[model samples]
Target: MLAANAEEAEKFRKETEAGDYDLLEGEIWWRDRHQMLIDHGYQLRPRLRPGWEPSWNNSNKNPLYCEDAHVGLRLAGGGTIDAVRIMDGKDVGIRPIKRVSSERTIFKNLADAQHLTGQDQHIAHILDTFEDDRDPDLVFVVIPLMIPVWFIASSLKTISGIVDLFKQLLEGLSFIHSKNVAHRGLWSYIMLDAPSMFPRGFHPSDYFQDHSGVHQIKVLPPCKASGPVRYYFADFRHSIDVGQDAKHLIFGYEHPVGADFDAPEWTAIGTYDPFRADVFIIGKIFNEKFISKYENIDFLSSLVEAMTAKKPEARPTAADALKRLQTITSTQSFFTLRHQLVEKDSKEPESLLSENINILLDVAFHGLKIALKMPSRTISLVRRMKRGSKEKETAK
Candidate 1:
C-alpha cells in the first residue's frame, strides 16, 4: 500500500489507541522507536494503516527482536539531489539498523559499492545516515522512496515487461559481484522501481489537501516516455564484501536458516563462496517467479536451472550469468519464435460444420421469434404517429 495521507493516518492512530490496540507489544516498540527518531529530526511520513507491519524475519520467533524496520521518512531540511543536501521537502525512505556492528558494516558496504558502481542506474543509492542521540543501538539509513518491484510486476501486461525487469536486476547484480560484494539476501521483495520515475500513476494532490477551503491545484512532473522501466536492488543489511580474490572463502556457520532465500550451501558445514550463494539466490527468484509462471519465457529456463543447481560449484558466476542473459536478449529470432508459438497457442481450433449449422439455426429461430412480435410493434408505431398528427393539427 502507498503511504497514507496525514488525516487518514491520524484517524488510524486514534482508533488504535482508543481500542487499546496501541498497547500491543509490537505497537509499543514501534511507537517508542518512532518517537525517538522524530526527536532526532528525522520526520516520517504517515504509514498506510493496513499494510505497515513490523519488519521481522520469520525465523526470529520474537516480534520485538527486529534487526531492521522499514518506514517512509524524509530529511528535515528537505530533499537532497545528487549527493548534495537541498531544502525542497521531498519524502525519502528509512530502514532502521538495530545492531551497532551490522549498522557499521552496512554503511561501509553501501559506500564501497557506490564507489564501485559509480552512477550506475540499477543500484539503489543510499543518501545519508541518521542516528539517535540518546540510544547507541538505534541508527537510521536514508534512501530514495522507491515503489516495490512486486507492485510493478503486478502491473506488467506482457512477457517482455518481465524480461526487461529481470535484465535490469541481472545488470545490477553483475555490477555488485564485479565489485566483490555479495548480497546474501536477494529476492523480489528487495527490488524496487527507479527513483527517476514517480510511483505508477500517482498524484500529489491525492495525498495532500488544501486547508483554507480554497481550490488549490499544482502542476505535476511530466510523464516519462514509454520504454523499459529501470529497477534497482535494495536492502543491503545482509550484504558483505568478498575482497579482490575470487577464491577467497567466507565462512557462514552462524548464518540463519529457514528462509526460502537462504542458499542451501549456508546450511551445510564449512566455508562457501558468498558470491556463488548470491547467484543461487537470484536464480531461485527467477525460476520461481518468472520461468515457472510463463511458458513463453523458456529462453531463460536452462539458464535459471543452471544457476539454481543444488551444488554451489554448478551455479554460474554473476558475470557469466549476465553474459548469457545478454546473448539470449540479443537474439531477435528467439523472440520471433516465441511470438509465433504464443499466437499459435492462442488460436481456437476450427468448429465442425454441424456446430456451425446449429449456430445458424439458433440465430434463425431467434429472428423468427422477433418477427412474430413485429405486428404489435407496427401497431404501436402507427398509434403514436396518429397521436402526433392530432397534436400537430390542433397546434396549427
Candidate 2:
C-alpha cells in the first residue's frame, strides 16, 4: 500500500546502484522458493528504471511484462509471461512468459484480499506478484524487465502479418480463457509489461492508482491471424472480474473475432463469456484481413454480412472463421485467370512504365489464371497479345 512516484522511484534506482538492491542471482537465488527452479541458461532481473514508460502511451511503471528472467524484451503494461526454459540450437533459451491462470487456485486466493480486490485488475496471473521497493515499505514488481508487442506492432504489413502480431496477446488471453478467467478490461494497453519492478505485476510508480472508480475493456479486435499489426487493450487498474465466461459490455471491444464472438444478451453485462468475446475479436481480425479493407470489396461485404448477424446464436466461432478464411488461400500459384482485378488507383505512375511491361504481363496473366481457376488463360493471353500488335506497340 505504499505510494510510489517518480521521486521515490529515482531514489530507489540510485540505491540499487549504491549496492542496496539485490539482483537475485547465483547460488542463493530468490526471496521466494519457487525461483529455485530456474537455472543454467536461466537468469533473473529485478525492477529497473530509465526503461521509460511514456505518460500518454504507457502510463504505468508496472505493466506486468517485467519478469524474473533476463529475456530482454519489455512492454508498457498488463501483459503476460511465464517461466521454464526451452532448448535452442546448441543453447537453451528462456521461454517467453505466459499466464498462470488468474482464475486458478494460487492467484484467486490473492484476489480475496481487500486492498487489491476492487482496483480493476485485468492481468492473467502472477508467477509471484507482490509489492516491494529498494527501501522498506516501498511497492513495486520485483522481476526482470520485459517489453510488449502491442507497443510496437504498427510497422508490419499484409493481413497475415498483422494477424500474427497478436501472438503474445492471444497466448495471454487464451491461457486465461482456458482457466475460465475473464479479463474484464481488455483495453488498448493491457499488454504492457512491468513499469518499474517493485510490485512485480503492478508497480506503484508505473501508473496512477485509481482511488476514483474507473471502467474499461482491454484490447478488442482479437487476433485473426499471426502478424505484426497489433491492437493495444486496456488500463489494468480498472479491470473487473464479473464471472466465468460472463458476457460484459465494453465499448470499442466489439470488433468481430471468429464467428462465436457473441453475448447471450447484447449489452456488455453479466452474460460475458470470454470464449465468445475472444472469438468475436478474432472475427474482427478477419474483417481487416480478407474482407473489409484490402483489395476485394465483394468478398469483404459477404464476410461482414455473416459476422454482423443480429442474433448471438447466429455468429460463427473461431473454428468457423478459420474455415471461412480457407477460401482465401495462403498460396495462389496456379499462374493461369483473366484480368481478375484492375488497378486504376495505383499511386506509382512508374508501374505504367514500358520497361516493366513484360514482367507485369507475366504476373498479371498468372494471377488471372489463379483467380479464374483456369489453366488456359496463359495461352489465351499470349494469343491476345499476338493479335493486338498495334496495342502492344502503343503500350511500349
Candidate 3:
C-alpha cells in the first residue's frame, strides 16, 4: 500500500511539472507576500495564493481553454496589483512604493488637507497605507480601483457629457494647484470612477473581460442611466509641492518623457515651470482625445489653443483656465449642449451606421419630449433655446 501511494504522488508531481502552474519571475514577489497581504485584510486571486494547483491538471481538457488559466496575470507596471477587501468585498488597488517617496508623502498630505473642498477636489483618495512585513523600505498603499477616463469618455454621445468630463478634470487640476502642488506627470494618470458602468465588475488583468475572464463586460454608457461619473487625478509619482510663492522651476529628467514631451519647454535649455507644463499636457490630452476627433466642441478651440501655446509662459493658470471654461460653457445653448457630437471621420462603415442611428434616435427622443411638454427639464431647455436665439439676434 505504501509503494502504491508513493507511485501516485510521483505521477502527480510529474504532471504538475509538465503543466504551467509555476509563478513567473515577475509574479513571484506577490506570491511570496500573499499571506502577509491576507493578514492585512486583503486577498489576492486564487492563483497567487500559496499551494495553488491547476484545476485542469487531471482533466483531459487543455488548460488554455479553462476559465482560470489567466486569473492572476501581472500588470505592465511591476509595483501595482488589484486586490479584494476581505471585510466588505470591495475592489481596491495596491501598490508597493518606497516608504520615503514623494508619491507617498503627497498622498499623505492630500489625505490630511483641510482646505480642499469635496466639490472641486478630484484627486484619488487613499484608503489605507501600511509597511510591508519583510521589507522596511517598501510600503503598500490602498486606493479605489478605477479604469482610464478615456474608457468612459470615448463612448459619450453628447457635447454635455464631454463638457462635464472636462469640467471635473480642470477643477481637479485647479484644486491641486490651490494646494501649491504641480502634477509633473499629467495626462496618463487621470482615471475615471464609475462603478455603476460595470455592474458585473471586470477582470483585473483584462479590463474588457468579465471577472471570470469568460465573457466581454457590458460597458454602460456614461449617461443619466449609469449615474454621474467623476474624473480623478491619480499616480502622483512625479508630483512636487512648489511652495506658496510659486517660483520654483523643476529640472529633473535630462530628456523629455511622459504625455507632454511635445511641450516646447520639456526639451528647452534649462529648468521650466511644472505648472505651465501641466497646462500644456492637459491641452494635448484634450485635443488628442476630443477636439481633434470630434467635429463639434468648437467652443473649446480657443481654450485648447491657448493651453497648448508654443511658449509655456503664454498658457493660462489652472484657475484662469477653469474660469475660462466655465464662461464659455455658460454661453452655450441647451440645444448645443445636448446635440449629438459628430465625429470628424467615420471611415468604418459599421461605425458610421451606428453613429448616424444613435444621432437619429437622440433627436427623435428629445423632439418627442419637447412636443409632449414634459415637465421642468423640457421647459427649461425650451427657455434656454429662446434665450440663445434672442442673444444671437442682438449680436447681429
Best by lDDT: 3
Lowest-scoring 10 consecutive residues by lDDT in candidate 3? 252-261
Structural similarity to truth (TM-score) of each candidate: 0.60, 0.35, 0.80
lDDT of each: 0.55, 0.36, 0.75
Question: Where's the lowest-lDDT run of ten residues in candidate 2?
Answer: 209-218
Q: Mind giving the per-residue lDDT tens digits that candidate 3 earns over 1-396? A: 121455665665565677655666656678888989999999987777788777656544444434555745555355578889999998899988889987788867875562345443787877888899999998998888887765566667778888888788788788778788888665557887888778777777677777666577767766534455878887888788878765768763532355543567777778888888878888888898899989889899899999999888899988899999999999998656866677886557776667566656666687675567568887899899999999999999
Tens-digit per-residue lDDT, 281-351, candidate 1: 88888777767765567877888888888888999888898888878877745233223122213434443
Q: Which stretches of candidate 1 lie over 4 Å from their true place?
A: 1-42, 46-86, 112-117, 194-228, 252-256, 333-396
State the lDDT at 276 in candidate 3: 84
Candidate 2: list runs displaced more than 4 Å.
Answer: 1-153, 166-176, 183-272, 285-292, 296-308, 323-327, 330-347, 350-396
lDDT of 2 by residue, 1-396 (tens): 121686755654454446443332321222232343232332222332213222222232322223221222222232322232323212111221223332233234433331254532334323233332222432222222233433323323223333333333454444444344444332243443322221222212222221111211122122211222222332233233445534543454433333232333335443434455554554454455434444423433454455445455566543454445445333322221111222325435564353245335656665564556655777699779887997878899
Model 2 lDDT on a 0 to 1 scale = 0.36
Clashes of each: 0, 99, 0
Clashing pairs in 1: none
Error of 2 at 183 (Å): 4.1
RMSD in Å for all candidates: 18.4, 16.8, 8.7
